[model samples]
Target: MKFSTYFNDWLYGQDGYYTKYRTIGKGGDFYTAVSTSKFFGGSIGNKAISTIQSGFLPSDTTIVEVGAHHGYLLADMIEFIYTLQPQLLDTLTFAIVERFPHLQEQQKKYFKESFGDAVKLIHYNNISEIKLDSAFIVANEIFDAFEAELVYTTQEGIRKNVVVTNHQLGFEPCDDLFLNAICDKYGIRQGEIALGYETFAQNLAQNIKKFEFITFDYGEKYPRNDFSTRIYYKHKVFPLFQEELNLNELFGKSDITYDVNFMHLIDSFNQAKIKNVSYQTQLKALVEFGIITLLEILKEKAGESAYLREVQKVKTLLEPTGMGDRFKVAIFRKESHA
Candidate 1:
């Protein structure tokens, strides 16, 4: 079976698809930037307002977020916008493209309790359902979750790692339309290449007419030396070889993601006719929006300890030791000026 298909079975299948398992908190498998600190979303709002006021978007601009979990970032973004630009909130749209029913219900409940009729919400089962004319979109840690292909580059060419049924479940060399495209794109090369093998980006581009879409993921065009594909289960990192056939039993319950290959992402947008694309690290993106000023305010009003605590929180998003270099942000817009 295709790796993406396997991912969908676990992430959206009736039994395996869930976020409530030891996930998203102290007892969870992992913590995101939004869960780490309010400042992360707050800083996003600080720039979102500028984007809205810059007169590039329409008055009825819809702000859509894919892979929004529990509405934490949405809540924080709206709150920050409310504090700084309250009037604009009255003329905005909030939409979430989520597949999991549980998370959709949770986000719906949050919006209902928080904004009432003040905000317009449109929920979609997938990005293909989006029919917006223009919008501002934000997706944090979204692209990495897409399925990836583990291919061993041999002297002949690139061979895909596919799941096959032998004695039990084992991996074998398989080729399909998707894998063929990967080999054609990368050409015959030697070395192990973990291609982020999903079409979610292309699907999103084909659906949305024009959007100021932004995605934050971890990956690079080139690697320095050691490159490996691993899985994370409640913060434990294990190689793909270890799981083998048992990957379904293990990773099905946990989050399975891979480092994004931005080249593929950029190519997808270009194919979909999206223009004015740009990229930046999470640290530079946050700093360019000016978060240090916010830190200074906390320092004067609160104690130094509180300020230091805030600094630590900001570091998680900015410091290279953390998500700074690990996470990257890519922006795609319809116009060249934006």
Candidate 2:
């Protein structure tokens, strides 16, 4: 079947891919930071709090989170903010923009149980509907979901690869104007193939007027010494699935994701004129924002020897060569005119 057909069939509404993956777990298809540990959420909460306290607050200031899978991070933010300043929690408005209805329903259920009507949960199917203005937008593991167009460079010129045969899943080269435009913008010459993440990044950045944007994912900048793309499957990196992994199989049926292009993201932000850009690994951002302090709180709450072991596991998440380094944090802040 064609990709569009397959995607439509497997990912329609409640009876499709969204519901299928909702049941995933330890032995199931995939896992994210939220699935791994609450520490990730705690660390993000710390950053959000710091951002809010550091002069980004307006009377209408809001926290807009994209890809709020299972509302784990939202719950952490609400709980952490309540602990820090209960008054602010009352003023805080939480908006969750999710694509899938089933996931949005899950978010509603979780928020209703956690905060009742105190937290405002706004669900959206498209990013275009997200209104900006003094909002902090957080997207964890969200960039890789943007559909990428494949391109290959040849001795003659550049060629765009389009799926030609569905049964064999064969790719054929064609001349696509949009792909050519992207190649020109990125200065990709002959004999080079690249993903279209840069274009997606640029589109996302251009849509927002005023907001603090941060993306957490595993990806590298362009002009890499390594020629291979970074893709993960089943909590492990596999080479064979790097280029040909199907989106339906990767996200809907399994836990697979590609590393984002951090340099491209930075460049896109620059082109969009969004200022105060900062890039760090997730671990560094966490430590700089006081994740250790949160762990101490967790330790105090547990007061058990086993909790120390859990702390060690969480510490490993911050190691430079581990998830801490693999996962990056990119932030862009829009200054207010008033």
Predicted model with the maximum TM-score: 1
Query: On residues 43-111, what C-alpha lDDT tens digit does candidate 2 reach at each position?
Result: 777777777777775534677788787888878777777776677776667788887776888889999
Off by over 4 Å in 2: 1-19, 23-25, 155-164, 184-209, 223-252, 304-309
Q: What is the lDDT of candidate 1?
A: 0.69
My TM-score estimates for the predictions, one after another, are 0.85, 0.80
Lowest-lDDT window of 10 residues in candidate 1?
Answer: 188-197
Q: List runs of model 1 lying over 4 Å from the truth.
A: 17-22, 155-158, 164-171, 187-207, 223-228, 243-249, 297-306, 336-338
Please provide, for model 1 over 218-238, each residue's C-alpha lDDT reduced to its tens digit, 9 standing for 90 to 100.
887543223254556777777
Candidate 1 to truth, TM: 0.85
